[model samples]
Target: MYRERPAGFARAVLWTSTTAAGAAPTRVLPDGCLDLLWSSRGGLLVAGPDRTAYLSGGGPAERWVGLRLPPGTGPAVFGVPAVELRDRRVPLGDLWPARDVARLAERAEAVPAAVLAEVAVARLRAAGGPDPLGARVAAALSAGAGVAATAAETGLDPRALHRRCRHLFGYGPKTLARILRMRRALALARADTPLAEVAARCGFADQAHLTRDVRDLAGVPPTALLPPRPV
Candidate 1:
């Protein structure tokens, strides 16, 4: 089972999931976000922004609660550049002082969602909130803007934009744009829209283009990720 709600702090998401013992691994598609996680068995860990789908480890049944921080927001909360943590999951203890992580872990174990939200709020407040540039770049790209256009909108030259994007998102703007586009296409697909229509609406050149991008990012074809259409 999995559920999520807005964190109400910095556009983050509070989520929880439980896997049955011996269940197949779950595929987690990238969405340009980082997660602070506490599992019933693993204590506290941080999931970095992923460039591709991450397959969860299959193990004994376990419960997980996480705070999913939006792109650019994580550096403020985690005190680390997004690129350093990209495509990796590290224990919170490795990043913070062990003693502090221990106390935080205790609170998280007692009340996972609330504790994670509290920690995020405190950290973001101390850092003066996420960089405003992140929101602008993400909005532009998610709206189907090209990288150069997005850079122009954000008032940054190409190189400067790429540098800032590496610090804010785990990758450059072009990669982020592709990831966001794939997510948009998937949303339309989930609404039962025709594949060709979804491709057209989400800015793909064609259904084949959509299929290739989805497979590259999500590790599966669109049909495998969505429910079968009725006859």
Candidate 2:
């Protein structure tokens, strides 16, 4: 199950899961988000923004819970450039001091998913408020704006936007654009939209362009994403 964070951190999300028996590796596609996860057994870990699908391990007894923060928010909460954590899962202890992480874990592990968001909210408030422009930047880019257009809409020049995106999202605006576009495409594809129309609606130059973006960001073709399950 999953729910959006209900408090000050509007872009945050939380979810809980019980792994299924004999499950294949889960294909977690990139959406430019970062996850803070705790297992019933594995304790705490951070899942970074992935360029392509991350194949995660699975088993029946592996219960877990997580909070996901939007692209620019993790840095304020985690105190590191998003680029430094890209495509990796590191122990929370590795980022925070062991003793601090132990203390935080006591709080995190004791309550429901809501408390996890509260912890991040408190940390984020202490670091100053959430990034003022990150949402507008993500919205503009996800809506098919070019990097330059997104910069203009967000009042950032191209280089400035690229630098901020790299720090906050672990990639430049162009890559963020592609990832979000594939996300858009996948949503439409899952709804039974024909690939040609989806490509057109999502602003891909052609079906081939859409196919390449899917391959680049999801590690699959459009047909694979069209079905209810992973290929």
Candidate 3:
């Protein structure tokens, strides 16, 4: 089971998940977000923006809690470029000094469940705020705007947009747009929409286009992504 609620910080989601019985290995599809996770059993892990799926083994009764930071918010809070974390998960000690990481780990282990969110909120306040234009850029891409159009709307030229996207979303504007579109398609598909209609609604050229995008971004075919439906 998985559930998400507001993280009480700008541009973040607080989520928790428990593995189901006898589940096989699962892969997390990229949705252009970064995560800070705390496990009672696994400690702290920073999930970078994944260009492709992230795989992990699991079974029933494993509890996982996390705070997912939206694009552009991570650089300030994590003190690193978003690009550095692409397609990777790193221990906090790798990015910060050992003492700092140790102190953070101690704090996280104390509460078991809520400490990660507390750490995220404290970091948000300490960082002053998230990227001012982050929301606008994400909105434009999510709405299926082209990179050049997003650049024009955001008052940044194409080259500048590419640079900012790398720092903010861990990729270029085009790739971010692709990721967002695929996500849109996935949401629609999950609602039982036909692939042809899903493609059209999400700005794909056709069902075939949608299939290719899902394959490219998620490393799986479209059928493989849809969950089993009840009769």
lDDT of each: 0.92, 0.81, 0.83
TM-score of each: 0.97, 0.90, 0.92
Q: Candidate 3, overall lDDT?
A: 0.83
Candidate 2's residue-wise lDDT over 99-177, tens digit each?
9778767876777476667778888888896676777888888888898888888888889999999888888998889
Compared with the true structure, model 3 gives a TM-score of 0.92
For candidate 3, which ten residues in a row score worst on lDDT? Answer: 55-64
- Candidate 1 Cα outliers beyond 4 Å, as residue runs: none
Model 1 score (lDDT): 0.92
lDDT of 2: 0.81
Candidate 3 residue-wise lDDT, 1-231, digit = tens: 779998776758888877755677677888788888876566788899988887764655566788888877887677788899998888877887889777877887666457777776777788787777777899999988999899999999999999988898899989889888888899999999999999988888889989999999898988899998888
RMSD for each of the candidates: 1.0, 2.7, 2.0
Q: For candidate 2, which ten residues in a row score worst on lDDT?
A: 1-10
> What is the Å distance of residue 107 in model 2 from its true position?
3.5
Where does candidate 3 clash, by residue pair? none
